[model samples]
Every structure is written in structure tokens, then in C-alpha cells.
Target chain A: MTANWAAVLGSCAIAYAIKLSGHLVPHRVLQRPLVRASAALFPVALLSALMAMQTLTTKGAIEVDARIPAMAAAALALRARWPFIAVVAVAAVVAAGVRALGWMS
Target chain B: MTTKPRSVIIRDAISIGIAVGAYAISFGALGTTSGLTVLQTQLLSLLLFSGASQFAVVSIVGAGGNPASAWASSALLGMRNGLYGLRLAPLLGASGWRKPFAAHLTIDESTAMALANDDPADSSHRGARTGFWATGLSVFVFWNTATLLGAVAGSHISDPRVFGLDAAIPAGFAALVAPRLTTSLTRGLALVCAVVAVAVTPSVRPGVPVLIAALIALTTAMKFGEPIPPTTEDVSS
Candidate 1:
């Protein structure tokens, strides 16, 4: 298998092991404050980072583009309590419109 | 506590399934655009089976990060699923072969539905079990089916940028994080992490900045010494 495939399978193994550990490990151990805190906040932080990475840069360099407006539109849709799919759609439409207008790409 | 009828549970599960599963289309499209084959994408859904984690992998790879970075980020995101499994373990009380199955199905929606139906006085946990299984199976079927459909269709699209599908990546992450930022502290942390990620991007490799931001956020959270109550179902899964 290629490196990508290996990464995919390795990720799968790690994910499953983590999941099964929750079932197999004692509940008390998992309930510790640090463990719980890590689980709760890690995603919040990682996702925020991921969003910034995707929106603010292209190919590992800082670049401004249509993704900015797309994210703004998505934020509005989320604030309005629009459905998840609609939020994504609004972002896509806004980005497409912006790029089409030659404002950004 | 009163349990809803079994039919209601089934309906709710399927509706939630449909809602959540529809996002798999984005995953499918993004996966292909990131250079993953349709089969590889499908395997991600079937094996990894967690929405945010799968998205992390694709986004990291699409950004030209190395394979190791892609694996670490995705696995880090998948850590939450393990927490969900922790929450469901006592409640679901599965055994033998069923243990693995139940563990795999433990996700935000399943845990939320199960706990919502649980009664402190009811030792049998019948309603909780039903909620867990129904929601889990519903999402599994819908998610896999949607992934297949999206992958097939996305393969034909030559330019994701033209369709704004490229922009959809960040938008999707924003949606995932929005619901979780229920508290002011979490929101602040998110903002800080976003700034940190952008600030460090040029100095570091593609995925390393994200990991750095995450480490900083974790340390900050630890310093605060209170786990943010994950009250809402952060329903990307």
C-alpha cells in the first residue's frame, strides 16, 4: 500500500483503539478531571485551528481569498440557526460568487 | 424520567441520521479533491467513521501536510469519540462481540440520545439502549450511503474551486465548532487558537501549526482547571 493508504489504516487503528479503550478501561479512570478536560477541549481548539488554517492560508502561506467571505457567510448562517447543510451551501455560494466576480480566488 | 415511544425514538434517530449524513457528501467531495480515491474515501467512512476526524485527515492532506501529520491530527480529533464511548459504556452495558460494535457506534448523537432517554431509577437501561442502537445504526447506514454517492459524483468534478467546494472546507469546520462554543470561555479559547494557528502557519509546516495551537489551548484549559461541560451534542459525527 501507498503512504496515504498506510496513514488511512493507521489512523483507523488508532481511532478504534481509543474507542475500544473507553469500553475496556474502567470508568473511574476515564472520569478523571484531566482526561475529561482533554477530551472536551481538544476538539474545540483543534477545530478552531483547522478552520483558521483552511481559511487564512493556501499551500502553507498566508493568502487572502474567497474563503474569507465564505467563512463569514457560514458564520452568519450558523448564528441564524440555519441547518448545517444550509450553512455549508451559503459558504459555497458566497465563495463561488466572489470568485466568479474576480474579487478573489 | 419518561421515555419516548420506540417509534418516536426511531423517527428522531433517522431524522438526525439524515441531517448528519447529508454532510458526508461534503466529506466525499473533499476527500476526492484531496487526492484520495473513492475506495479510500469510502474506507474512511466505514472505518474511521467519525466526521470531524475524517475531515481533519482530508484537510491536512489537501494542504500538503505529510502523512504522519495527517494521521496525528485525525487521531487527535477522534479522541472525542473515545470520550463518547466512555460516557456510553455504563449506559449501554454491552458485552462480548457487542462490546466492539457498541464502542464503534458511540458518537455525539448516540450518546446524547441515549442519555436523554436514560432514567436514574431504571437499572435495565432499555430506553437508553434503544436510543443508542437506533441512532447509531441510522447514522451508519445513511453516512456510508451518502459517502458513496458523493464520492462517485465528486470524481467527475475537475475543479473544486469553481464550485466553491474548496471554501466549503473552512465553512464546515466553523459549523462544527460553533455549536460547541456555548460558553464564553470556550469561545475565547477558539478565538485564541484561531489567531495562534494563523500566526504560526508561515513559520511552521502545514499541519504543525494546528498541533501547536491545540497544545496551547489544552495547556490553557488545564490552567483554568475546569472542564467545559459538553452539554450540547457537538453533532458532526
Candidate 2:
């Protein structure tokens, strides 16, 4: 893929602009219930979508591989309240092991 | 405000700062394996500093998607930063040149750190200001340094699947989001979105499916103003 400077610069500007504008926005606007609720729920949805996009998509196809089990291990460890580093370490080991077994490659 | 020693607060801040910094190493590795140049990934970490947005952009671009859509998705995920900025403005009390810099540093970890420092006993004065600046600045330093190491390592290791680094990004996302599934409603909503996103992935462009799944949030938002506590019955019920 081509390095699209425009998109990079545009997105960075938009992100920065959004932050700066948020400060300038009247407290009245922010105090609205709808604004508060939406902001709160937005990340809950976005991050879930991102987890899906990363885990399920591979080489232009939707295929489950080592990432699936690895993530399951991560979920389990997270449920157990493992520190963030341990959670990552468990996931990497599981995924690498699954790959080594030539299960999905 | 409860008279906790300043050393305790500093200890917590340094630990958090280190934790977030170590996490950035994976971003650097994932960024490069996904086809970003070392410079590009480094700058994304250094400038954007928002984990999800950076990951989303590189994920899309690495998957052969257009930059516009990538940017759009990244921008969407980062809109929360605007909300964060609103909350942090008065707390930081930055003026003139420092305003933009403070804005840049407003993120999940920093916000969480500062907000946690709110000791109700001393409502007028708490360690939030200190927590915010300390966490943000420390994260900045550690994150950049770790990124350099990860990117350099990423370059040396081709076929990232060899080390299962391919799985690192998604696993990291799952771990990050897991704690927020405190309520059954959030758990259920996230589960549905994940299922829906995966179902649509084969049929759509790399990023489009995820954006479409976000439409699910709108429906839930309309139906319920707030997530009911886990022990309660469904809001509709």
C-alpha cells in the first residue's frame, strides 16, 4: 500500500482538533445527557469492534487461527485479574505453541 | 486528602507509567509487522499516543485498506479523547502554550490516574493534578523508548507469525477491554458486537465491518440510558 501522507496528516489534525475543540466547547453542551452517555458507551463498542477486526481478519480472509485460543487464554487470565504483563505473556505463549503444532499456521 | 504519604502516590504513578510503557513495545512490533515503516510507527506512537486509534489505523492500512477509511476509523475511536479533554481542562489549569500540550497528554491511563487521586476528604485539593502530569509525562518517556526497542526487534524478525507476534495486538485489545465488562450489559453488548463484526468481516472491507458493528451501540443506547447494575434485572424487563 502506498504511504498516504494526506490521510496520516488529516487524521492527526482531526484528532488534535477534536481535543482542542472539546476544551472550547461550552460546559452546557457537555452537560447534556445524550453527550455524556454516548461518550461513555462509544469506547465500549469501538474497542470490541477492534478486537474482532484484529483477531478474525487475516490475509484478506476471515479465518480463526492461533489468535482465537490465545485470546481466550487472555480473557481467562484477565478474568482472574492477572497483571497486564502476565496476560500478554500467556497469550503469546499459547499462540506460538498453537502455531508450532502446525495446527493452522 | 486522606493523608496518604506523597511517596505512595509517587510509587503508584511510577508503576503505572512503567506498565503502559512496556505495553508500547508490542505496538511497535505490531506496527512494523503490519507494514508500517519504522519512522511511521514511531511517529504514530510519539504523536498520536492513543493506543486504540494507532492500532486501528495500522490494522486497516496493513490489511490493504485505504488510508481514508483507516483514518476515519482511527478518528472515531479517538473521539473519546475529546471527552477526556473536557474533564481535564480545569483540573490541569494549563493556559497559553501548555494548553495544547496538556490536551495531547489526556488519555485513558492519565485520566484514570488523575481521577483516582480525587480524595473526597479534600475536594478542593487532591493529587489529581500531580497524578495527571506525572503519569502522562512518564508514560511519554517510557513509551517512546520501548517503541524504539520493539520496532528494532520487529525489523529483525520477519514473518512475525514465527513468534506469534501476529496474535499480540488482538490479545492485547482483549486484555484491555476485559475489565470494562463489569456489567452484564456491557459484556453482552461487547459480545454481540464482536460476533457481528466477525460475521461481517469476510463480506466487507477490512475496517468497514467494525464500523458497521458500532451501529449496534446506537440501538443499545436508545433502549437504555445507562447500563443497569449486574445484579439487577434487564432495563427493559
True contacts kept of 2: 0.55
lDDT of 1 by residue, B1-237 (tens): 777788988888899899989999888988888788899889999998888888898888778887788788887777777777877888888999999999888777888889877777889888899899999999999999999888888899899899998889998899888888988878988999999899889999878987887687679767876557554455523
Model 1 chain A: weakest 10-residue lDDT segment is A1-10
After superposition, the stretches of candidate 1 with alpha carbons farther than 4 Å from their true spots are B231-237
Q: How high is the TM-score of chain A in each model?
A: 0.94, 0.81
RMSD of each: 1.7, 4.5
TM-score of 2: 0.89
Which lDDT value does model 2 have at B7?
A: 71
